[model samples]
Target: MNSAEVLSSDLDLVRRSLLVQKSEILNKHMEFKNLQHSSAKATDEADAVVQDLQDNLNIQLHERDQFSLLLIDKALSKFADGTYGLCECCADVIDVRRLKARPLATLCIACMEDQEAPGKHLFQ
Candidate 1:
């Protein structure tokens, strides 16, 4: 109905979405761990090379999932602190649209752009 109500609803949705993502990542991580532990023995050099490649790919995927989990956890913590959807850099309320699009986003668009800008020194 009102802006506050809408924002609350949006935040609730974001929280649910983040939880779902966290669960999915955790499930996938567990499955990958099981697969790694049960990997088939290499029969020959070619098989060994393929197994190595597959192992390397799995590690990379696991690392990526771990990073995603971290971001999701941070976002969920923000909700607990009553600061979800607020820009970390400006302390301003991030646009609800942006939050919907990227539930793990910490910085608002302007701040993100500035951070990504080339030749922009942070220490200067």
Candidate 2:
């Protein structure tokens, strides 16, 4: 049942993502404050630095948003499929602790280890 409706419990994952978003917003506010102070003296190099920081922050926030969305979507799908907290690969049951820590994870630790470990044959 590969459905896309997340379980109610997955809202905890969304909450965690929201916390990350809040931190990012705080960082952006700090950066804006610094930019405001720097623009007072407004040298070309300083202007460039502020612009670069803004660009970097934008990219970072975009990536974070994308990651959050991916996690949420995974949770939603699992809810629909009645496979929430189960490993997508190998069909093994995922530990509750693992899910709490990493709701976005699709693979069980065993599967993850298999992927990360280079087999001897592959090294040859």
Candidate 3:
């Protein structure tokens, strides 16, 4: 395929992925909000602990979704700058499979592994 076609295909993939994730996040948020409202009406002391745990889990999920949204936004911005699919750390083209799996990935696998290595920051 031509470069323009390839770019259009990749952009469509990333956009679709982001839209799906955002839809999921919004649905979860609404569910959690409903749960919170329902729980507020509960008077049973035994259920308090369970509710607390559920609330904590919901908060964690929301935080994770927010971070994912940020990554998606950054990826979209990179697309606008004609830099999408290029590793942020090494300027190498990230593998198409990896990009398909993680649409917002900024680093190639090797660079990601290096960043994730134990004591990597200590050496730097």
Q: Candidate 3 overall Cα lDDT vs. reference?
A: 0.83
Question: lDDT at 3 for candidate 1?
Answer: 93
Candidate 1 residues 7-116, lDDT tens each?
Answer: 89988998999999999999998999888777776679998898999999999999999899999999998899898888999988899999999998889999998899
Ranking of all candidate structures by their lDDT, best first: 1, 3, 2
Return the top candidate by lDDT.
1
Question: What would the per-residue lDDT of candidate 3 be over residues 55-103, giving only the tens digit for each residue?
Answer: 7988998899888778877887787888989998999988877888888
Model 2: per-residue Cα lDDT over 1-124, one tens digit each: 2322453345456446645755675676577667657656646997778877876886677677667666666666676677876777788877656766776677889888878787844874
TM-score of each: 0.89, 0.55, 0.79
